[model samples]
Target: MDGTMSGVGIDIRDDGLARVTLRRGDAGNAIDLTTARGLLDAATACERSGVRAVLLSGEGRSFCVGGDLREFARFEGEALEQHLLAVTGALHEALRVFARLDAPMVAAVQGAVAGAGIGLAAAADVTLAADDASFTAAYTGIGYSPDAGVSWFLPRLAGPKRALDLLLTNRRIPASEAVEIGLVSRTVAAGLLADEAARTAEVLRDGPAGAFGATRRLVAAGLTADLGPHLDREARALAAAARGEEGREGVAAFLGKRPPAFRSAASPF
Candidate 1:
């Protein structure tokens, strides 16, 4: 599948890799209502297609600059409130779908990543930012609170205190600092960002899909699960994986001193 939905582009390859790109480069990929709906549509397609991996990126200098204030400025009072609600509702639902996916997501961000952009980047299992990238929590600066899971993800990724500092102060941090604070996975040269992101997504696509899904669920559950119960969950997951076809292939490959063919051995979701 290859098409553009509003300002979002969806390209799903035969190799089970989905590329979702923010296509409104001239508008800084801002999340207008149409863009929000487009994102949800793209995410839904990926889930339905059972894509093994997703790569999210932007087409221009900046990944995204957050909500389109210019569009919001057109409304007032109840109209503005209604408009924002629709925007956030769709955007949040898109994030929820992406989070629940068995496939992993990789975000390649460059230039400005602010507000909702930060949330989108943080939502990824792995986020690769260009060395020239900059991040900021622009919500407070605009007299608006956060949407797009920014409030939820930041506290977990960067710690509560750091998250608050960024949110309250609206400070812009470089990609290096973002990595240091755990806001991003790593920073690559601007020119290498696309290749690195594609490489990472391809690696994930070629991995054991079932095992990867289990691992993703485990980590997300572990974040809030109690130690004892989490261990039990882990045990159950491990046993199931060990009894599956991928497990047998992996063991056989090890004994034969050969790389495992996880993609071929794994079952469909």
Candidate 2:
């Protein structure tokens, strides 16, 4: 859509917010070689976008349909293995970058978010949704297993039983139910989704850039490793950064009973 023949479409508005939209609505935002590469490229672009926040969403009815069946139809044995390797490897690398972004990521899900889309959303720091949003594991029902890091994200977010049940049954979970199940952070009206997402990003943009990144790192570390060390590291970083320019401004503003302005761009990791 960006005048390029890629499966995914990426556009960054001047406000420093990048939106990665799955443009292949005809086949849903199914994962293909082009899409996979496009995904990595988009993540790289976002990392350099100078945007304080990023949102991953879709352009049409469905968020993403899953892997492209058309691409897989040509697979035999070794060729299939090669294709899978390339796609998954590229995606995982991009996920690591996306996860380490300094500013928060809020995945805005609307309509259908299936399979790999779940994996993508789970990688985000936060997820917001519309009531019509629905989720499906959509792997086993098709005689295939999970890919695009779905296995890792699903079990961690939804728990083992929940993950297994969804993958096995391919049941649909609506946005409201998803929040209740701890799958999404908030559910908003479909019409206000864009405005809401922008507002949230703006709020984070006003905060200290270093503090935001440090806090995100702490949460991620706590999720995967020991909580004590994570807190300890966070405390140390906060103390050190508090002496910097941004932190000095924050302190002065608080003492003056005013708001402190901050730059939007920050480090990726």
Candidate 3:
């Protein structure tokens, strides 16, 4: 991805994971209009490429400090809201696309994750962080309300009280504390974090793809549809999955008391 001016350095690897890196290392990998636009393209590219999952990371030491303040100089009267809407609209679109997939997303967060950076991380299905990483909201400190998905994602992941405290106080939380408060999935050793995340993602990718997707839909059902429709959807999906080859293999393995092979199976099974 060529976003030199934007500083949104996106690299898509053929290993079935795209890395959307914020590259403004000088300013802590801050997001700018160009960067946000680049991010929009990157998200589209990932889905278009059919990657099972994307691994969001940073190129430099910092994940993303926040939106670029230098660009703040360009802000005009009514254009302010329009500009924010333009870029953040891209962010929400990306989140919507990523949310549709059941492939487990693993965010490898390190260094500082502040402001909109938290939104990006929360968009992922799972997050893996170094024990030393730090997370902060920092929006109010700079005279802005949370523009990212913080309002929607944070409270659910980290719990209402913790999310409220962080957003209101603009406080920074250590990665260890984040784990304790449910902000991150878990803390890993600095050097092994990437490998650990990869292992987890592999486990997900190797599992029953349709079933996994259906499971995700079931779990997230509570956010919208009611009990009757929810159960109907769940039953339909589960039945479909159970009728497939993976389900047959799983059942055979259970009866035989042996691990059945999944990587190879008969067609239309």
Candidate 4:
């Protein structure tokens, strides 16, 4: 694996899986400006590395506790405003990059997921929470607004009404309820998080990357765009994929009754 460590740790393995870890365990992986920059850097690196899948997780008791209150407490007035602007800029860029990337993203979450942590989980294509995991939109309690795409993804995932409930009330929802409400893809035992995430990542990494990427973009666009334009977009994407090497291999594999070799040297993603 090719690895780098900072506030965020990125390890791009041989199988083209990028493992992104939030490294601030002692601090519940809270995002300070520096950590936000690290996140952006890690995401940029993932795009540049041509990885086929991404696995995001935090290193400790919680996935993340959101913005570092201690860090925020240090600034005042204009200084505070500028600091927050810079922090959110970096954080948003990272999430945008991951969302637009060809590689699919999966998150393994445990412990507390609060504030911007909810954004992270929402942003992932699939999120697997440990049974002990809990989610809370802690922004209102702290007299802050949502950031890190929480306002965007949450409304779509849980519907505007339910999303408002979480955003306004700051009520804590455990993994089971999160799943019931579609806030998370599913829940697993805490001990199974790593293995399940890894397995899911591997499956995505070995799949038809181009098709997966196109489908992801389509889904995201469908949420906002009208049907006619969306259909045009889908048609173009399908035609493009059908002309690609991966598409040819998928068809050939089916005819041959064999698994598709999406990772072959000449494969198109």
Error of 2 at 234 (Å): 2.1
lDDT by residue (61-85, candidate 3, tens digit) is 7778878778765897788778888
Model 4, 156-178: lDDT tens digits are 98899999999999999999999
- Cα-based TM-score, every candidate: 0.98, 0.90, 0.85, 0.97
Better-scoring candidate (TM-score), 1 or 3: 1
Model 1 earns a TM-score of 0.98
lDDT of 2 by residue, 1-269 (tens): 13332766776766566677778877777888888888888888878765677777777777787777788888979999899888888777788878777767877778888888888877777788887889998888888899877887777778889888888999998898788767788998999887887787667756677777778887767777777777788789889778877788878889999888666223332
Report lDDT (Cα) of residue 232, candidate 4. Answer: 95
Q: lDDT (CA) for every model shown? A: 0.94, 0.77, 0.75, 0.91
- The local distance difference test score of model 4 is 0.91
Q: In model 4, which range of ten residues has the least summed lDDT? A: 260-269
**Which stretches in model 4 have alpha-carbon errors above 4 Å?**
265-269
Which candidate order results from sorting by TM-score in descending order? 1, 4, 2, 3
**What TM value does model 2 have?**
0.90
Runs off by more than 4 Å, candidate 2: 1-5, 264-269
User: Order of all candidates by lDDT, from best down to worst?
Assistant: 1, 4, 2, 3
Tens-digit lDDT track of model 1 for 27-62 = 999989999999999999999999899999998999
